[model samples]
Target: MKRIESSKAGGSQFIPGYVQATDYSDLESFMVAKLKVTGQLDMQIDSDFQNVDGAVSNAVVPELWTGIRDDVRGVYIGEFAFWYSDYISFIAESPNGQFTSDEEREIIEILSSFRTEN
Candidate 1:
């Protein structure tokens, strides 16, 4: 993992980590399957950087995705921000397929398994 900072903000810093996968889409797909969406995700996920939607569409609070511009719809989940596509649409929102206690535990385990190989 690497830490990056903004030179303009008098040294505001952020830690960034990327989880690379050969089947990268698999993780996104897992997230979608694990998510419990009560309604539509309000954006598209499968595309690249050009076409994306913001958190407001999903009713997510701004604080949740820091550094996200109003014009930016893609949201960062941990070190990764997801798009509004089928593979990337996942949220912790209640009643929107709230993760069960066991599921939450599983997710924690999954995230915990991550390590910076470099």
Candidate 2:
């Protein structure tokens, strides 16, 4: 239910509203989410996902990512963790505001297509 209406505020280029959330149960499982809104009603950037890990044994390293793309913008969520450091990345775009959708999509694709160098 955590969703952001736009991609503005917080010095971000997108429109200006967004929702984000994080959840933790015990010390090994956690999740983060984000969403963008349009005109205060529609969900132009419809997107979400979760990342899980085995913190107790520290023997598992897992990550997952998913995305939806369009000319307007792209929405993406990634979850991954290493030991005590948990990482999540959420992104929305407005390369130039006048046309934030296209830019947003491009950003989403790039983030979705990342690979670890190690």
Candidate 3:
């Protein structure tokens, strides 16, 4: 489990999460599973951009996905996944759910910070 936390509030504010990288097949199909997941609501894919992950097997075209999880138990989830060649890197968080606005901003910051360390 991984979390982003801030201690500036006199206490830690955090989002519980999980992340992993592995092999997989299909991008849209992978997302479709999350969308159809029982607790997922308001889910959709943003095709705003496409990029590469040079650290992978050659000719491995990467596809990214951002997802929302819906569970009526007041659980809101934010997820990110990248698929390329036969591998996948994924992240899911907000175990207690998220405020859409707050989640969006934080997600942007996280995405923006993604880079390859030489």
Top TM-score prediction, candidate number: 3
lDDT of each: 0.29, 0.28, 0.27
What TM-score, to 2 decimals, does candidate 1 have?
0.26
lDDT of 3 by residue, 1-118 (tens): 1111111111111112222443233332221111112222232553222222111101111223223212223322322223243234433344444325555455444533433332
* Local accuracy of candidate 1 as per-residue lDDT tens digits, 63-109: 22333332322333432344323233223333343455665555544
Q: List the residue pairs that clash in candidate 2.
A: 3-19, 4-18, 4-19, 5-17, 5-18, 5-37, 6-17, 8-16, 72-101, 74-105
Ranking according to TM-score, highest score first: 3, 1, 2
Clashes of each: 11, 10, 5
Highest lDDT: give the candidate number: 1
Better of 1 and 2 by TM-score: 1
| Candidate 2 overall lDDT versus native | 0.28
Tens-place lDDT digits, model 2, residues 16-85: 1122333231233221212232222135554542222211100112222112112222233332222223
Task: Give the local distance difference test score of model 3.
Answer: 0.27
TM-scores of the models, in the given order? 0.26, 0.26, 0.27
Give me the displacement of residue 59 in model 2, in angstroms. Answer: 27
Which run of 10 residues does model 1 get worst, by summed lDDT? 4-13
